[model samples]
Target: MSRYVVSFMKDVLGGNGRQIEVCQKTLEIDASSEGEATELAKQKFCKVEHLCEWSLHADRIQIKSADFTS
Candidate 1:
């Protein structure tokens, strides 16, 4: 299994009147691949936020590997 960081982001107007992506929440998940991590994160995120779907709260989802090496 690999660790992954899943970030939920939403687009909103900034102070400068420009659209910007804001991170609403982030979760760390362990899965076999990026795709698996994404699905797992989505389910967990929706359940935690009490939403029927992930998109209901977040505009987009980002997934990245969390493993680091020297």
Candidate 2:
């Protein structure tokens, strides 16, 4: 198991100009399989429209998996 950082880039809401904002979040995942990690990340952060555009970067230090971490 390992941790990963998902970075998001999306259009900024309530802005006068057409600008994009970048956001980042970290997820601790079981690297035992790629599917597990992907699923875990989606479940945790995919609820929001902006976060759904996130892409995983480097893995981080491991932490215990949770049902939800918000």
Candidate 3:
């Protein structure tokens, strides 16, 4: 298994169709492949994001990218 960093982001749309990110969280996970790590991270994201007071719709939240670090 390899270590990966999954970046979770909240869509912050600025002027002129530019996307900004005001909120983000990175999760370190160990998985056999990037796909598996992405899935696991998404699951974690859902559980963690809901604990906050902010209302983050599914559309507003996304896994920006997942990178294998090790």
Q: TM-scores across all candidates?
A: 0.90, 0.38, 0.58
lDDT of 1 at 29: 100
Candidate 2 structure lDDT: 0.48
lDDT of 1 at 20: 94
Q: Answer with 2 or 3, whichever has the higher lDDT.
A: 3
User: Which one wins on TM-score?
Assistant: 1
lDDT of each: 0.94, 0.48, 0.64
Tell me, by lDDT, which candidate is best.
1
TM-score attained by model 1: 0.90
CA error at residue 52 for candidate 3, angstroms: 13
Taking the tens digit of each residue's C-alpha lDDT, what string does model 2 give over 1-70?
5554433333454466665553445555556555666666666665543454334422232334344556
> After superposition, which runs of candidate 1 have C-alpha atoms over 4 Å from their true positions?
none
lDDT of 1 by residue, 1-70 (tens): 8999999999999999999999989999999999999999999998899998999888999988999977
In model 3, what is the error at residue 69, expressed in angstroms? 9.1
Candidate 3 residues 1-70, lDDT tens each?
7777766656677887898775567778788887888778777776887643324533333333345356
The count of residue-pair clashes in candidate 3 stands at 0
Off by over 4 Å in 3: 13-19, 51-70
